[model samples]
Target: MKALRVEKPNNISVVEIPKVRLEKDNEILIKVKAAGICGSDISIYSGQSPVATYPRILGHEVTGIVEEISKSVTKFKVGDHVIIKQTESCNNCYACKHGRDNVCVDLKVRGVNIDGGYCEYITVPETSAYKIPKDLDFKTAVLIEPFTIAFQACSRGRLQKDDTLLVYGAGALGATVIQVAKSFGCKIIAVDIEEEKLIQAKNLGATYAINGKSPTLKEEIQAASENYGPTICIDSVCNPKSFEFLVDIVGNAGRVVLMGFDTRVSEIPQFKITARELDIIGSRLQHDKFEKVIDLFARDIIQPKDMISHVFHFEDIEKAFDVIASKQFRKIVLTF
Candidate 1:
């Protein structure tokens, strides 16, 4: 099998490796069809991700066909099209027992903490595999994982139909937030430094697009929300500066969800948070949202294809990473 491995910072290559086999009775062997490159993958390549280890196979957003299944795997069989839920939780943890497995104390995210799907074949536990719609192509199916992040963020922010949402960043996750917020009937204000991404956000149903670089960004957001600040703010940029703007642009009693992850710590405006009674929430990976996102895609509520700007082959892994680093596209997928 051919797997794309990151040996260290700024080092990645496609290397021939032994094929994976089912290690547990509850595991299934999948013939990877398509895998999406995430920002975390780029972080791993550049040695920025805190959790990622060296010589890791870097891919987590994946879709595949079940090539083989262990005898104990009755939920999935051969030829079943499935989407991988990269987060594997130890069901015994307090969080998992309380229905919050996404944040389990002993959680392991494939591609980040372990080997992932940037390969010809991969093996995962049956519990981590969900059957995708047969009609959905692999490229689009691969988006379910990322969409789940957006969905979880929106849910965490307690987005309401009557609320106005201010989303920072118009990258892939930000675009997903726009689409999800739109589905909930929330008016969206998409903010980004890139005009191209802002345009893409508008096309994805953002009611307003504001340049984060603008001198009066807070005023613009206030005006967009009819003289009141946004009722909810989502920070997808993960920058300290964006975090500051999130606190500044949200209305009194508004909810702010931090969806992006960075190691650097940012100062929190304690006075504003207390004076306005703001709710600051942190959203991590998906928590039981994959199936719902898949349904949304099936019903055309969220079109994954529109977000896909580039597709590369397994053999062109280096070129793919280069393009991802360029940040010119919304989403990039590697087809096996």
Candidate 2:
């Protein structure tokens, strides 16, 4: 099978390795159809992601067809179209036992800690495979994984319909957050450094788009959020100081969702936290959201095709990465 492997930092290629097979009775062999390249993939390629292991097959947001299934598999069968749930955890861990396996003590995400679905064929536990609507194209199905992140974020932030929501970063992940927030009937303020991206965010259901580079950014956000500051803020930008900036703007008793893996220390004042009774949450991969996201796509409740900026053949992955340097794409997918 052909697997797109990052040989080392700044070195990736289409390499032929021994094909994967169903190593466990609960596993199913997937013929990968489409995979979305996440920012983490670029991080791994450039040797920036702290958790990424090199010589790795780089894809986690994936959609595929079940080519074969183990005898023990009952959740799916041969020829089932599925979107993968890429999280891995030890069920015996404390977090897992508490039904929070998304933060399992020994969590390992495919394509980072292990090889992922950026190949001609891959095999995974049937537990990781959720069947997609037969009519949903592979390219659009791949967006479901990103939407799972959006769902998890909203869940963590306790998003409510009447609350004002402010989202930072109008890129791929932020776009999903805006769309999901729309489903909750919340007023959304989309923030980004790019004008075009902000425009796209509005098209995707953002109530207002504010350029982060604007000198009146705070005032603008205050206006859009009804002069009381937002009740919930999701920061997809993940900059070192994002914590402080968000804390200064969110209303009292509000929640701030942090999605980045940045390691820098933030100087958020303890007084501000206590006075506002703020909730600072860190949202990771996803927790039990694949099924909900699938339903959203399957029912045509959310437009997934609009999320795609470009599609490239699996072999032209280098070209796709080049597009990332332009800083203009939403979701870039690789077709197998």
Candidate 3:
């Protein structure tokens, strides 16, 4: 089997490796079809993903075909087309007992803490596999994981049709939020430093797209809100200070969700939040909605293909990492 291996920070290589076999009776083997390069993949490559384990195979947004299923596996069998759920948690942990599996005590992730799908094949727990619509292409199926993340975040804030929403960053997640918010009939203001991304957000259904680089961003958001402010603000960039501005841009009693992965500590306007009775939430990844996102894709409700702007081959994995590190594309897909 050929796999892309990350041996250390700033080092990655494609090499022939031993194929993986199901080590558990509840496990299944999958033949990799297509895997998407995500922003976190770049972080892991540059040694920024905090929980990464070295000598790991780095790809989680994946779609594949089941080649073999363990005797104990019942929901799937040979030749089932599947998209993977990358989260790993101890089902007996305290969080799991409380139905908070995302914060499981012993969490492991594909392509970071464990071997992932950037290979010819991968062995995963049967619980992590979700069957996709047979008619859907592999490339589109890989997007379900991230789309589930977006859905989880939106749901945590209790997104409502009557509220105004502001989402920061125009990356794939940011763009998806715009479409999702619109689906609920919510007015959205999309913010980004990149003009192209803001344009993409608008095309995806953002009511107002503001380029943060523009001097008039605050004014524009205010104008779009009819002199009020957004009722819900989401920071997809995860920068604390950037999130502070998102918090500031919300109306009294509004909610703010931090969806980005910023590690820096910065000052936030605590006084404002305290006085306004606003809610601040930190959302994790896909919970139990993995199948729902697949249904959305199968039904053509949210087409993530529009965000797929780049594709890389197996032999060009390094080149793919280069482009990802440069932050040059909206989304990049890797074909095995």
Candidate 4:
């Protein structure tokens, strides 16, 4: 089987390796059809990702065809179009037992902690793969993974129909969370420095788009939220400064979802946390959100096509990364 792997930091190539097969009764073999290049993939390629291991097969935003399945795989079969979750966890872990397996103590994440789908074929437990609409485009199908990320964050935030959400960063995940929150009947205020992305956010159901560089950003957010301030804030920008800004901007008793892994020391005032009694949440990969996202995609409630800005063949992975570096796209999907 031909697969793409990073031999080490700053070194990557496609190599022939043994074809994977189903070895468990509940397992299925997926023939890779498309995978999305995420920011983590770039970090891994550049030796900047803290969690990725070397000699890794790099792809997590994935969708593929089930070319083979064990007899016990009653939920799927050969020729089924499917999207697979990227993480596998030990069922006995404290987090897993508490339904927070996305952060299991012994969590193994594909593309970060283990081999992932960057090849002609891969195998996964049947439970991890969910069937997509048979006619769905693979490029769009790959977005389900990211939608899960957005969905998981909203879930963690405990967003309600009456809540007003303030989303930092109007890129792929930002646009997605806006859509997801909109589905819950929540109003959204999307903030970003790029005017184009702000416009895109408005198109994706954000009630307001404020320039992140606006001199009166807080005032604008207050107006957008009808003076109550946003009840939920998500820091998709994922930085210490952004975290502090959200803590200060969100409404009293609001929920703040943290989405970054930066280890920098952030000086957060304990007074704000105590005075407002805010709910601070740390969201990781996802916790069983694939099912919800897949249902949303199948029902046409959300458009995955809106999130994709570029598509490249699998062989042009290098060119794809170059395009990313040049900053000319929103999201890039790689075709097999």
Candidate 5:
């Protein structure tokens, strides 16, 4: 067996490792087929992620074929195609008991807290794996995890049909948000400083794509929303600037959902929140959205093929990291 290991911050290598087997009746062994490199993976590589542990395998957005299944695993078989949820929670926790396991007190994200699918083989609990249509390609299935994040964000926003949505970034996640919102019949306003990404957003069904660097960004958003301002604003950038701007762009009583990761303390405007009665919500990982995303893919409601701009062989894992660090592509996948 072989795996990509991050021995420490700023160090990663592909090394031969011992093969793993299903040791529990509730577990299934999968042969890794494709995995997506995420922004958090880049953070872990650069020593920027707080949750990442050293000497870890760095891949969570995974799609693989089942190589073996325990006798007790009746939900899956040896040849099934599946996507990994990555986030495994302790079902006994208060959050889990309330159907909020995504925020479980003892949440263990596969790639971050344990060995992930950055190798030839991996094993995961049957509960965390969802079967996908056998017709779906492995490269496309790899996107299910990231797409679920967007799905959960939109779910948190409680976006209504025909409502206007303002998205704070036009990167991969931002594009997903745009597509998901569009699927729900919401008019989308995508904001980003990169002109190319804004163009991509427009192609992804955003009604209006505003450059974050525009001198009249607020005015553009206002005009796009027909002067009432967007009813829902999702901050996928999660920086102080985007957070404050989200507060400013949303209409009165609008919902604001934060989906990006940032550790720095943000100075929020208490007055704006109090005066407008805005509903500020924080969305974590995907809840029960994987199946919906797969259905969306099947029905062509959200096409991810165009979003995947790059692919690399498993042996060129380091090169893939370099491309991700450079922000040269919308989505990058590693194929075994």
Candidate 6:
């Protein structure tokens, strides 16, 4: 068995390792076909975001086929194409009962709390395995986890039709936010430091895409919103400085959603948040909307393909991590 293991902070290797055994009756073994490196993965690769342990496999954006199913796993069978949820929620938790499972009290996240899919095979609980459409390619199936994050963000924001929205950072997650916002009929404003990402936002249906480095970003966002700026803004960059600009661009009583990973302590504009009556929300991973999000992709309603900018072979997992760290590409998928 070959797996990419992060032996320590800022260290990773793709080498032959002992195969994962299905010791639990409810778990199934999946032969990974493709996996995508997420922004969070970069944090784990570097020394920024700490993992649960050293020598862990750090990849959550996964798609694979079931190679073996435990006798207790009745929901899935061998040879079934599947997408694994990045996190597993205890169904008995209070949050899960109330439909907010992303914050389940006993949530266990793959790639962080447990081994993940940066390998030829992974063992996942039957509950986290979703049977994807047979026609869907491994690349697209691998995208469901990240896109589900975007979906959950929109769901938490309670987006409405015809409401103007702004998304900070045109990374893969940010691009997903743009597309979902557009589908709700809200005029989309996308902001990113990279020109290529901004261009991709427009190409994917954002009403307006602005480079955050542009000299007149404030003016551009204002102009795009017909003088009253966007009412709903999502800061996928998760920086205090970017949130400061977000506060400036949002209209009175607007909502701001924060979704990125920034470990450094930064000050928030608490005064502005209270004075402007803004709703500031922090979103995490996916909830119970996996089935719906996957259906959306299968129906061609949301094109995940547009966000996948680079594909790397399984052996070149290091290069894939490097590319993701470079921030020069949108979404990088590793095919086995």
Q: How many residue pairs clash in all the candidates, one count each?
A: 0, 0, 0, 0, 0, 0
| Residue-by-residue lDDT tens digits, candidate 4, 175-257 | 88888888898889999999999998998899899999999999999999988889999999989899999998999999999
lDDT tens digits, residue span 68-93, model 2: 99999999978899988887899998
Q: Tens digit of lDDT per residue, candidate 3, span 287-334?
A: 887887887887788877767878888779878767765776777889
Tens-digit per-residue lDDT, 224-290, candidate 1:
9998899999998887877887887789999989976666778885998999999999999988898
Candidate 4 versus the native: TM-score?
A: 0.97
Report the C-alpha lDDT of model 5 over 67-88, residue by residue, as the tens digit: 9998799889989999988788
User: What are the Cα lDDT values of the candidates?
Assistant: 0.89, 0.90, 0.85, 0.90, 0.89, 0.83
TM-score, ranked from best to worst? 4, 5, 2, 1, 3, 6
Write model 6 residue lDDT over 195-294, tens digit each, in one string: 9888889988888888888899899999999988888888888877877778777988888888866667666758888888989888888777689788
Give lDDT for model 2.
0.90
Q: Pick the candidate with the highest TM-score.
A: 4
TM-score, model 2 to reference:
0.95
Instruction: Work out the TM-score per prediction.
Output: 0.93, 0.95, 0.93, 0.97, 0.96, 0.89
lDDT of residue 70 for candidate 4:
89
